[model samples]
Target: MLRNRLTRISAALCTLAACITFTACTATSEAQRQATASKPPATDCTAWVGADRNAMLPGYLLPRAQGTTGNAKGPTVCVPLLLTANQPPESYAGGDYHISEFTADKLKARWRDCKAEAACFQRVNAQIQRWLPPNKARATRSTGTVDPSGRIDPEGQVDLRKIRRPAFFAKAPYREGIAEAEGRTYTVEFTVPPDAFERIDLKKTAPIKLRGWYLEGTGVDDGKGGKVRALALMAPGGGGQLTAIQHPDEVTLRTDAKTGKTESLKFPNATTETMGQRWWRENLHALNQAGFDVLAYDRRGEGLSGGFSDTNTLEQGEDVFRVLGQLENGRGLRMLTPSGDVLEGNAAAGRLLAGMKANEIPLVLGGYSRGSMSTAWAMTSNYVASCTFDLPEVTCAAPRGLRNIRGAILLSSFASGAGYVGDAPDLADRNLFLGGMAADHHILFYPTSETLAGMHRWPAAFFGKGLWDRAESLEGTVAAYNRIRGVKEIVLARGPHSIETWPESDRRYLRERMVAYAKTVVVGGRTVPGLPRERMWKDFKGLVATTPDSWEPSSRPRTMEKATEQ
Candidate 1:
């Protein structure tokens, strides 16, 4: 019966497509068909388990061979979690895959039916949340002011003119990694110091630190017709320390130039931690080594900073803008027009730096992936010098309001598959298994040099070499920059996706070009230059190992040479 239902859905779609050529209709029909076929038939309860049902089970991974020689295998059974029925409807809408609750009897039933231990275990894997069914309710970026209790308060004023107070400004630390998908949650506990307390009642305070997923719902409507929502933090319930998972330093560097002042915001990847924060830590080093004095912080939900109910790309960009305004050098720069209205700023950093000691400084903004999007959006401010890095995959206002950027240093990055190309030849074959090599820190491709010499500070082991293929192309991102006339250069590098792992030579070359360009155009009153066409490509070729004499290949796991005697 289940199969019949799916077949009927597919047939209906085909018939609908034949009748209407309208894009939306055709698309919707096809989507419906795909959804039905892709999902396990709801009628097949014999092979199905829901999220709540699986949670009662005893494991997280599918059964596998165990012991030194290997306990070879077990029964092979298929247990599919009917996400639509098993998981909560709200969870599906909120981008959460956790089964909200489970009962002990359900676990026993699931286990008894498993053909193999692996099948039972696989049913409960929390990681499956990352692979949610398509067309399901998706989470998008949204923002509202957080209240005195660390709860989201949309009615609060965000006027820059007023000395605003941040609610729940305190520290909460906890164990790094603990697995409890169903009810796992962290409560942020902190206080709003009286001195910093301007608008809110001083006596009120609440939790700030947390990890896991949250949902948004309208409770209090901010007067402007915008409804308020809370980030549904999934916590089993308790008091725990919210340890800083990643602390990103947001540095805005400015150089006095003959023409005026130039400023650059660099977001260095985090370099402090080992296993847990590898992606973030490496990003800090990559941006730092690349010459960006990045403006970054522990994202609201991650580091030691305040907790947020919900955050999206646009919100993050707004936060970046807010930080730039708060800088010492950013005062009185004029964020809006004389007309008193504008999302884009004429001298966003300058206005933020107003009344400060530093004056006439030009600013450059850059970020990695999400951070890069923040940088791109900053270009809309007239005070900034340049905007560069991976193109943000999210929506952002154009760079139209800012001064003509002197240059852009984009890394292995992209926002879509349409324009992206596969890996360059040299980068495609480089060995990624170098034992504890610093190459991991670089995240970008290795230099074409004979050895992995200066690349040691990077952590290359965390990713596979296949990822290099995608990093080589920016998926035709240059077209986006071309829209901003007078933009100096767009330098694309080879290697892994992140720029930090690029060869030192590549790093230095790009930085030299950016600084020189900044000095001439924004400072020296000279024409900004573009990267000489072949510079980026030539560097990519150098990473390839053509002969045995080439740099020693990165190390990898070796198979046992001979069978051990049992």
Candidate 2:
């Protein structure tokens, strides 16, 4: 009705204004407006274009400016949410709100105290209202440290140890039937299950190895042919000590729908773990099953791997360079557990190499959380500092760029912004989104800025995150997905920040999807189902409202509902 009324109004205005003019007015106006959205006053549409390109600071969770019609100083032009995502915001119920009145040091100490035994820790979390925190932005945090418990004191403090004992029903699950994968997202890795992957196929051989300081997973069909197809190396989450992918058979128990009790029901396989073992067993299996020989290594100083290391950004990236280079050369990360108690897993599989040269193989690399950051930066800092690095999609992932790389898989990826897209104080007047929950989603351990600028350097990429993830922001991941200039796939499924927290079915599908994405781009050299790809972001001074033929649509501003937590 509004569009029809506008059409009639435009016709009336054209007719009324035609009496005083000699040429077609509305036609000229229509021609001047390049965007499909409502027309703005400027014939050039400069305000709309400018706002669209730079003003949508979604990282801050503030609303785009919606212009008013009668302002004497000209309209405060708006920019619609431009990036598209795989799912809508409603896929997740508003996450649970749990308060942590202490610091991470204090909280992690509690997990360590509990031995990570489900029953023991269940005792510790009695007073906590839920399994996860909303990660909302703080109005007045003394420090910027974001925990899963965004419910913080002024000093950026959260103490889970303080809330111990008593009632069984005080706390609710993030969702019944769904269990957290990494447990608290913020929970310390007090326990890690090694030998995490079980052999899914015996016909084609892949091996698990215990080299000196490295734990490795690698293999291909023995002498079966064609360059082992591809090799994908995945790293674990930075915070957890999880060494490898979880096996598919392992289960996570879910609470009964009627009651929020953990042990209420009789179903044994209540839920299959999404992430952090079979270390993400299914993802590892999917890639391997798709003919991509797989490798997963523990970062030095953490997991079972030896050697002292810090959480420095480039250090992890350097690890990739070492691991990938080693695999390419068919070298192991030192091999074996002192010759006796077992020549197990990959080592047990015997002579793991496929007898193919490095050039014959295509390389794909990735990881869970901070691990993904390592891969992204490694690709960035390797070379081509001044060039666009926009290789064609065919040669993009493989047969091109640094190290004949095929692609990257960034699960729980970094989307956009530096600090937080969560709520801020005194800024309620601005359109705030998701109540700033998950503001601490994948909170930064270091101070580097957003990595979106360098993501174009990546080849065929697959980005996945949960709908109600407390680990990373959904909007930011979508931003990363939309911004990548090459073949990319975004899988936003129903779950929390922890993939392991997702239902078993969703986990299985995602694992399969990862490999399928890899196979499509890695071997066949094609893009998968995805949103429109974009190249230029920061400095497009050209007529953005008119660039119609490219992957990016014309930037047109549109009105937005008042974004508030009603």
Candidate 3:
């Protein structure tokens, strides 16, 4: 009956397709006939298990020879779970082999019958026991935190006070054999599991420190002797302390740029912890090695930085300006701690910034995700203030607005008014910001695949009021900024929404391009070998041409008009 029902369904489908074209009709009809005829008729006691049923069973439940030697064997009896009922017969069984053909309902009935058979049930249950552990014996209790340091006692106990935050490490897999000699490292703090916090007797302590190392030849060996070497080594504290800037609202953790070991000071609030430290270190290390100063601080209401929580605001831009000013000239800089102690500015930062200014070193501003948005706004605010009230001539509005900025690097960032209408002011600010940028100023865009995917949906749901095409949206954005001067836009083939998720190749590509662009455009240094063309607009155009499906048609010009009107 089941087979007959399937046959009827197949016939109806073939007949419907037959109306579309004679050739498809004949071919489909013949294929359906062949499939139906080949299927054995269902038996009275058993039903047919089709391809769909076979796929439903978990793969690990399939019966197989026991032991790694493959010498062990099992009973020759065919278990219904392991049988491929839809396929051609591999062996002959009692009476008619057609009895194995069972539909879902019939299969369940047969399983009940098998369960009733004492001998068969015992055999099957025994086999099942080997594959699955008994429920009562399964592990369920939490074991607390497992120390990655391997310093715990034999019984899995440890001195919690000695625990420290872990260090992170990362290496470029794309440069596995070539650049495996070196690796990057950074400090890391781990979140404690909720269950661990529930332990009554366990005392909660400050984050412990662990040192991480990324050594060559540490990754999985690929039989070919070339390993994707990447290792993270974290050890307990060695008495090192981070400098803190105490403000009325918050205390900002500061790492001196003059240390030379410091890369970029990441704003903690801008991105989530999902952007792993290893990835952050890799990119920052590359820039640091190229003789660039990197500084990171927790923005207001994030990490150690104190203040109200807000994102991409003019106030945040002001905070950036203040930080830069502090770095440039530490004179009159002071931070008041909760204990009423006044902290003076670091002379090292003042000297570093002064030297750069004296030498006429151009600054490169870079940021990821919301940080990029913040950076863009900051630059815009500075540029807008510098221009004369009604003219293009420069006039100082603030003491530090990143004068002599050579380039901007934006990664995984969207336009100001990306998802909401409230961002219109910011969007307008960006338009003016782009107009203020010099024609020779370089801007590098590193949008991930995830970013493109998100932008593809922007016009339909969020930006419906405007005319937008995926390609046109991106290209027009750069063109709006007159990026024709010097622009490099590299779309990473694979990565999560965060630029920190970029693979080794993408990271290397970005580092090389950034260094090369800075060398040629900023510092007037020698051009690095193997760098892509100075401008990526042409390559981007080629990508759009070859992958037309990736881009959507632009909406009407009314969209832009609507945006401007807002």
Global lDDT of model 1: 0.26
Please list the residue runs of candidate 1 whose C-alpha ends up more than 4 Å from where it truly belongs after superposition: 1-128, 131-294, 308-311, 328-361, 380-409, 415-472, 481-484, 524-566
What tens digits encode model 2's per-residue C-alpha lDDT throughout 1-566? 88875564454333323311315533323312221122112221122121112222221111222211223253233322222221224453311100011112222334454544667545434422121221111111111121122122311122322211112112342121112111211111011111111111112133322111222224333333543446676766653333222234554434444532332111112332122544354465456545565566445344334322323334455455554444334344232222222232233232222434444556677777666666655554442121111111111111123545777888765433222122222222111111111121111222122244334445667877653333344444543454455777666543334565555555665676676676666554565543223312221111121122211112222332322111
Angstrom error at residue 315, model 1:
1.7
lDDT of 1 by residue, 383-423 (tens): 22112111112122222332323333233322111112332
After superposing candidate 3, which stretches have Cα over 4 Å from the reference? Answer: 1-274, 331-343, 346-351, 354-361, 386-402, 415-477, 480-484, 487-496, 525-529, 532-541, 544-566
In the range 105-136, model 3's lDDT, one tens digit per residue, is 22333435656788755654443333221111
Q: How accurate is candidate 3 locally (lDDT)?
A: 0.29
lDDT (C-alpha, whole model) for all candidates: 0.26, 0.36, 0.29
In model 1, what is the error at residue 38, expressed in angstroms? 37
State which candidate, 1 or 3, has the greater TM-score.
3
> What TM-score, computed on C-alpha atoms, does each candidate reach?
0.32, 0.44, 0.37
Query: Which one is best on lDDT?
Result: 2
Task: Using lDDT as the measure, name the better of candidate 2 and candidate 3.
Answer: 2
Counting only residues 3 or more apart in sequence or on different chains, how many pairs clash (N, Cα, C under 3 Å) in candidate 2?
35
| Cand. 2 Cα-lDDT | 0.36
